[model samples]
Target: MQTVANFTPNSIVGEIEKVLDTYPYNPYQQAFSIPDIRQQLIEYVLVRIPCADSSCSVESSQENTNQVPVSKIPRTPLQHQLHLQNLIHQGICVIMQMKSELISQILCETVQPVCEPSHWFG
Candidate 1:
């Protein structure tokens, strides 16, 4: 997630627009569906949890992921599922917020209301 402190409002809004524009304009042909995004989020979140010793590497994490059910290994199936769901929800919420902010900016800057007839005829 990006913080507002990282960039000026104008730059951030432009960047977001550029990213959104890269996607397929047709909803039916979209590259990433909600389930696909959710699965990606789960994988990302799983690999990101810090190890007990605080020196976990990608290789080590993969090893842990593949390990058998040993007594020392962390094992909580339901908890893990709930955590993944939470992460997915958070990811979607952040994207929605960015889009909302971009829409608000566009409406504020580009959209105008007609207030008088004098300008309309010209």
Candidate 2:
């Protein structure tokens, strides 16, 4: 979700390469089969929602790692909005990183057809 204003094309392309490089280089392993990154975003939302809800009996001292029910806590409108914004920001970061990496790979692959043959000709 990074805006065009925030990211130059070159930097976005670099990010794309970095993400692709994270995977093993096996031809059989499709890079598009990227593991479920959404789960991390879900976990972030889960943690923030419960923490924001003021009605939860669990003291703030309790660690966020515990799984708590949303129904167990009453969340104020403002609290919910704040947590929602936080979650949105986190989701955007994850998505933008993924997108940048995919675009980089596509650009590199596409350009290969044009740049590679000329080397042999010369």
Which candidate number maximizes lDDT? 2
- State the lDDT of candidate 1 residue by residue for 71-105, as single tens digits: 33333545433444454445445544544554455
Q: Judge candidate 2 at residue 51 and give its lDDT.
A: 39
How many residue pairs of model 2 clash at the backbone? 1
* Model 2: lowest-lDDT 10 consecutive positions: 1-10
Candidate 2 lDDT over residue span 11-71, tens digit each: 3334334444554653212433345433444444445444332333444343565735444
Give all candidate RMSDs, comma-separated: 13.9, 13.9
lDDT of each: 0.39, 0.44
Clash count for each candidate, listed in order shown: 0, 1
Give candidate 1's error at residue 89 in angstroms.
Answer: 0.7
